[model samples]
Target: MQKIVILDYGMGNLHSVASALQKVAPGDEVVLATTPEQAEGADRLIVPGVGAIRDCMEGFIRPGFVPLLNRCIETGMPVLGICVGMQIMMARSEENNGVDCLDIFPQPVKFFGTDLKENGERLKVPHMGWNQVQQKIDHPMWRDIENGSRFYFVHSYYVPAENNDALAGETEYGVRIAAAVARENIFSTQFHPEKSADAGLQLLKNFVDWNGQY
Candidate 1:
């Protein structure tokens, strides 16, 4: 059976994520790893987060975790990042007066700003609730999940599509936000698949079945 390690850096909905993974892949081993050594023999890695970027980074910086993550990326192990987990994959974020991230992707996370509007009406700052994601690429992670499928999101900051070649999905909230991104062995979602219902569950199952291919 494949072993899936969900990196628990003291932030994120760890129990919910783990429950969802177990529901999707009944036979697979799903572990919540608090340290890099706990994540050692993982066949797939999941990084999950929530709350402020600075706080997430502080918790993310375990002595050997970053190196282990980098090695996983280089070796083509399937990795999935969720919410602020996805944000930290970028080079940096505008949140908390600019926090440097893992730099797995070249994009920068930007704020939604106070003046966000759609159809001449002011939009909310933290874009909460369900929103449809427009698929931009045909990756295995998208298997069984329809284009324009609604996913649960709760974030004040987002990654813009500009200059980001890794953009795989897009969603609008006053402006277009990079809802999902993919490259080589990595796939990340700004939306919470664990909280996204059926479509989300299918996506998780697909990840469990995927072999880190394009």
Candidate 2:
């Protein structure tokens, strides 16, 4: 059975994400790893996070954690990042008075700003609830999932579509946001796939079956 390691740096919805992965890929071994050594030999790695970027970065500050992630990516092991998990992959986040991230993706995670309106209606700060994602490019992660499928989202900051050639999916909330991104062995989503119903389950399954390729 394949070994799927979900990095538990202490900031994500670990139980929920683990439950979802177990549900989707019953045959695989799903592990919650707190340290780099614990994550060794993982066939696939999942980085999941919730709450503010500052807290998430704190968890990531652990020694050898960042290097482990980089090794996974360099070796072509499939890596899936979720929500704030996705944001941390960027160069930096504008949250917590600005925080430097993994810099895997040379893009900045920006705040939605105070004023946001769609059709003249004031949009909420934490863009909660469901929103449709428009697939920008073809990839294995999109397998069997529809192009405009709605996914659960809850965030005040987003990765803007600027200098992001790895943009894989887009969703609009006031302005356009990079809902998903992919580069080589890595794929990440701004939306929560674990909470996104069947479509989300399908996405998890795709990651399980993905061979770290396009």
Candidate 3:
């Protein structure tokens, strides 16, 4: 059986994410990876978070996390970044501690502007609630999603990868943000799959079926 690991930081909807995975992939063992080596050994990894970017990096401090993550990607271990977890994959985030990220995505994380309005009101800083996502094209990562599907999203910042083509799906929160992104085995999404119902579960299922760099 392919073991699936979820990177557990001090904060995040870890339980929900883990539950969703096992419910979708009953044969896959879902483990919480606190160190680099454990992460490196997994067949698929899920990094899910709902906190700030700075705190998230603390989980990587177990030493060699960055390289382990890179090696996992190189070896084809499917890695999924959820919400803030997805933001940290970029070069840098415009948040408080704004430290360098895993550098998997070339773009920087940016915040929403107060002047922007979706339906005539100032757009909220932390975009919340259920939103619709438009599937851009057919990609294995997004194997079973329809053109427009609603997913639960909660975030203030969004990632804009240098290569626009890497975006698998997009959502509007005053402006369109990369809601879904995939680069080989490395895949990410701004929405919370655990909260997305069937569509989200299917996405997680696809990641479970993903044969990473291997």
Taken over the whole model, the C-alpha lDDT of each candidate is 0.93, 0.93, 0.80
Ranking 1 against 3 by lDDT, winner: 1
Which residue pairs overlap in candidate 1's backbone? none
Residue-level lDDT of model 3, residues 73-100, one tens digit each, is 7877788989988888888888875677
Q: What is the lDDT of candidate 2?
A: 0.93
Worst 10 residues of 2 by lDDT: 57-66
Provide the TM-score for each candidate, comma-separated. Answer: 0.98, 0.98, 0.91
Question: Pairs clashing in candidate 3?
Answer: 75-213, 75-214, 76-212, 76-213, 76-214, 77-213
Per-candidate alpha-carbon RMSD to the true structure: 0.8, 0.9, 2.1
Model 3 spans > 4 angstroms off: 161-163
- Can you write out model 1's per-residue Cα lDDT over 1-214, one digit (the tens) per residue? 9999999888867999999999999999999998898897899999899999998888888556788889999999999999999999999999999999999899999999999999999999899999999999999999989899999999999999767799999999998899999999999999999999999999999999989989
Model 2, residue 157: C-alpha shift (Å): 0.5
Report how far off residue 188 is in candidate 2 (Å).
0.2
